[model samples]
Structure formats: structure tokens, C-alpha cells
Target: MYGLIGKIQVVPGQRDALIAILLDGAREMPGCLSYVVAQDSTDPDAIWVTEVWDRQESHAASLTLPSVQQAMARGKPLIAGFSERCETVPVGGHGLATVP
Candidate 1:
């Protein structure tokens, strides 16, 4: 399984709008096992996004999806910067169905 964890900092007062865009784009992602958007506990302008996919290629392909592309275009102006991004290989986890 492939996973990504990213920290995004949005322009002040724009976090909720950005989060809404992300959530909308995440819906119906092919091969996506999980996708989560979280608010940073200590930073008002920071948000965390975590995703799990069946393959790295699927994750990459999602970038070209129309919804994702639209979200990127709409959210670009609200984004301040990215703080951290980490890629991972997930073995197993709760809520993720195990493949035989």
C-alpha cells in the first residue's frame, strides 16, 4: 500500500475553504483506501492530509483527475505553503481491508 502525509499551511482565514476543496476532491478516488483531512491542533492556518492508496501509481494518477485538478486550481490562491510531506509504504492498518 502507498501512503502520503502532508502538512499544508493556508493563507490566514482560508483554512476551512481549502479543507472543503480537499474533501470534495478526495471523494471517489480510484484505489484510495483512505483519505483524511485534519486540522492542526496548534496552528490555526495549518492542515494535515493523509491518504492511503493501493499502489503508488494510483496515487500519482489521482493528481490528473478532473476533481483534483479543479481543486488545485481553486485552492491555489488560498495556499500559503507546504510544511512537510512524507511518503510511506503501509503494511496494514485498521479500516483498511487486507488483500489476500
Candidate 2:
């Protein structure tokens, strides 16, 4: 499985709005196993997004999806910058279905 964990820095006071945009695009994604958006405990303007997909290609393809594209357009202005990003290989975990 493929995974991505990233930290996004939002414009001051715009984290919630950004989160809403992110969540809005989280549904109806093919090959998406999980898409989680979390607030950084210590940084009001920082958000964390973790995603799991059936394969690397699926994750890449998701970028071109209309819902994701719209969310990116809507959220662009609220983003300050990206702080960090990590690619991961998922094995097995609760809430993650076994993809055979």
C-alpha cells in the first residue's frame, strides 16, 4: 500500500477553512483506503494530512480527480506553504482493509 503524510502551513486564522476544503474532497476517491486530516496540537496554523492508497499510481491519479482539483483551487489561497512531506509503505493496520 502507498501512504503520504504531510504538514501544511495555513494562512493565519485560515486553518479551519482549509481543513474544510481538504475534507470536502476526501470522499469518492477510488483506491483510497484512508484520508485523515488532523490539526497540529501546538500550531494553530498547521495541519497534518495522512493518506493511504492501494498503490502509488492510485495516489498520483487522485491528484487529477475533479474533486481534488477543485479543493486545491479553493484551498490555494489559504495555504501558507508546505512544511514537510513523507512517503510511506503501509503494511496492515486497524481501519485499513487488506487489499489483495
Candidate 3:
């Protein structure tokens, strides 16, 4: 399984706007097993996203999709910092498969 945690920092007051774009993605993107976006109470401009994908390939491919691309475009100007990490799990919790 593949799980990703992404932390994004936007230029002040931009988090809500960014989160709105991300929320739009949740409606139509494919191969997404789960997704959550949150605002950091300590840092209003900071946003956190956690996503679980059926496979790493689906998640990776999503980056190139128009929906995702558009979302990113809306967010580009707002971004100040970003960090992402991915993990693989065999069992016990949420797990993802390799791209087929």
C-alpha cells in the first residue's frame, strides 16, 4: 500500500484557497483510496494532506491529470514551502499495490 503525507506552506491566508482547490480534486480524481486535507491551527498558512492510493502508479499518474494539474496551478502562486513523504505497508493498516 502507498500512503502519502504532504505538508504545504502558503503565503499567509492562502491555505483556505489552496484547500479549496484540493477539495475540488476529491470529487473526480481516480484511483484514490482515501484523502484528507487539514489546516494547521498553529500556522494558518500551513496545510496538511494525507492520501491513500490503490497503487503508487495511480497516485503518480494523478499528478499529470488535468484535474490535478489545474489544482496545482491554482495553488502554485500560493505556495511558499512544501514537503512530501510516501510509505509502503505490507499489512495491518491501509496498504497499496504496485502499479499494474
Candidate 4:
């Protein structure tokens, strides 16, 4: 399985809006196993996004999806910067289906 974890810093008061866009875009991801958007406990303007997909290609393809593209465009203005990003290989977890 493929996964991504990232931290995005948004304009001081725009986290909620950005999160809403992300969640809305995530709803129809074809191969998505999980997509979580969380607030950072220590940073008022920071959001953490974690996503899991059936394959790396699925994750890559999602970037080209119309809903995702629209969300990115909508969220672009609210974004201050990307602090960090990490790519991961997922095994199995409670909410994720087992994979070889």
C-alpha cells in the first residue's frame, strides 16, 4: 500500500476552510483507503494530512482528478507553506485492509 503524511501551514485563520476543501476532495477518491485531515495540537495554523491508497499509482493519479484539482485551486490561496511531507509504504492497520 502507499501512503503520504504531510504538514501544511495555512494562513492564520484558514485552516478550517482548507480542511473542508481537502475532505470534500477526498470523498470520491477511487483507490483511497484512508484520508485524514487533522489539526496540529501545537500549531494554530498547521494541519496534518494522512492518506493511504491501494498503490502508488493511485495516489499519483489522484492529483489529476478533477475534484482534487479543483480543491487544490481553492485551497491554494489559504496555504502559507508546506512544512514537511513524507511518503510511506503501509502494511496493515485497524482501519486498513490487509495487503501483501
Q: Candidate 2 — what's its lDDT?
A: 0.92
Q: Candidate 1: deviation at residue 52, Å?
A: 0.5
How would you encode candidate 4's per-residue C-alpha lDDT over 1-100 as one tens digit per residue? 8999999999999999999999998767878888899999999999999988999998888899999999999999999999999999988787863332
Worst 10 residues of 3 by lDDT: 90-99
* Per-residue C-alpha lDDT of model 3 across residues 1-100, encoded as one tens digit per residue: 5678878888887778888988986665577767789998887778888887777887898898888888888878988988655475424364432333
**RMSD after CA superposition, every candidate:** 2.2, 1.8, 3.6, 2.4
lDDT tens digits, residue span 1-100, model 1: 8999999999999999999999998777788988899999999999999988999998898899999999999999999999999999988869874321
Stretches off by above 4 angstroms in model 1 are: 97-100
C-alpha lDDT of all candidate models, in order = 0.90, 0.92, 0.76, 0.90
TM-score of 2: 0.94
Q: Candidate 2 regions off by >4 Å? A: 97-100
Query: What is the clash count of model 1?
Result: 0
TM-score for every candidate vs. truth?
A: 0.93, 0.94, 0.81, 0.93
RMSD of 1: 2.2
Candidate 2: the clashing residue pairs are none
lDDT of 2 by residue, 1-100 (tens): 9999999999999999999999998778888998899999999999999989999998898899999999999999999999999999988888974442
Cα TM-score of candidate 4: 0.93
